[model samples]
Target: MHIAEGYLPPLHAVAWTAASAPFVVHGVRVLTREVREHPESTLLLGASGAFTFVLSALKIPSVTGSCSHPTGTGLGAILFRPPVMAVLGTITLLFQALLLAHGGLTTLGANVFSMAVVGPWVGYGLYRLVRRLGLPLMVAVFAGAFAADLSTYCVTSVQLALAFPDPGSGVPGALAKFGGIFAVTQIPLAVSEGLLTVLVMRLLSQSSAGELIRLGVFARGNARQDGQQGDEQGQDRQRKRVA
Candidate 1:
């Protein structure tokens, strides 16, 4: 969810911008390292950024100058991890701010924290956890996307509450108001995003398994297999870790 242009107070805007800068800088380093190691990731990274821009642009308007939207972070977060998604997510938000007049420049940091950093990290963590538990790939992916969208809104609600506390009720009341607004629109969108992400992942698996394999998701799955196959895959993971 975007806080919209000039919705947040200047203090809040400046604080969030400062807070998000470190993550964005670190993401740049991570992206540089990954691209150096695998030049092929350039196309994938661009596509990921494009995906985020398109999906996030399909946003639903809400009260208090905010809006709910499908954060397309989960799929990329699963594939490239949150740090990489952080960079792509920022690019997507910046594009939207400039071209679409969606989120504001001042609120860029807050938006990034919610949609990029928080959502992707939450999604990636859940995906990794579910995969480790040997769940079906589809199930893990869907849950990750669904949860990521919800988490983004949750953070957005918090940001809004922090920025505009009700005089009588304060931040908690404002949080409920914002959260209520988001819940009405965000739940179904999150589900849709999950299904969409699953479709995309399936397409990627079919058309670009090699790329996914390079990302190490497949290796992790194979490492869960029983007996000698698992042993060899585990050894391979160890080697990758060492390298």
Candidate 2:
């Protein structure tokens, strides 16, 4: 669900922009490091951005008179890393705003904070947690997707509430209204995202995509190797520069 421009008050927009600045900065730093350490990651990040843009543009009408689309962050996080997913998400949002008018330019930062930042981080964290608990791949995927979708909605609702805090409405009322309205569409959306993510992960696991393995996008322990390689490469670069 893209929050259109002017939907949020100026104060709310300013606050969200301020809050999201650090995330954007951190994401850029992480991406830059990844790119420097593993040049091939740049291609994967571009692919993630293209995939996310397409997914977000394909929308279906939901209960709130607004259309909903897949976030695609789960897929990126499953394939790349969460921080990289944030960059992909930012690109996707920018394209959506420029081409499709799905989201507004003024509110791009806020929307990115909710969908790209909050959604992927929550989903990736849940995936890690469920996998750690020794759950099935499908279960982990479902949990991650569901949590991601729900968290995005929750964040959007809070943003809205902050912008338009009804004098007569309490937190419960806001929650009910936002939760109820979103749950109708988001539940099914989450299920769809979960299935898609699981299928993609399964395919990648079976394929000979060494890049995916190197990125730690599918296999659980593979990420350690990726990180180790990154670290070693960084050290080698430093040594060469010193020499």
Best by TM-score: 1
Q: Write the per-residue lDDT of candidate 1 for residues 1-243, one digit (tens) a residue.
A: 677999999999999888888888999999999889999889988987887778666654444346556678898799878998889989988898999898989899999998889999999899989988988898899999988988999999999999889788999999999899878878877887888788777655544545566776676455333111234455465446445
Locate the minimum summed-lDDT window of 10 residues in model 1: 223-232
Each model's TM-score, in the order given?
Answer: 0.82, 0.81
Give the Cα-based TM-score of candidate 2 against the true structure: 0.81
- Candidate 2: lDDT of 124? 85
Error of 2 at 38 (Å): 3.1
User: Which candidate number would show the highest lDDT if scored against the true structure?
Assistant: 1
Report per-prediction Cα RMSD to one decimal.
7.8, 9.1
Which segments of model 1 are wrong by more than 4 Å?
57-69, 220-243
Residue-level lDDT tens digits of model 2 in 114-233: 988898899889989998898766678778877787788778887776666656787657667777887777877776667666655554444423555556554546544323233446
Give me the runs in candidate 2 sitting further than 4 Å from their true place.
58-68, 219-243
Q: Scored by CA lDDT, what does every candidate get?
A: 0.81, 0.72
* Alpha carbon deviation, residue 218, candidate 1 (Å): 1.9
Model 1 backbone overlap count: 0
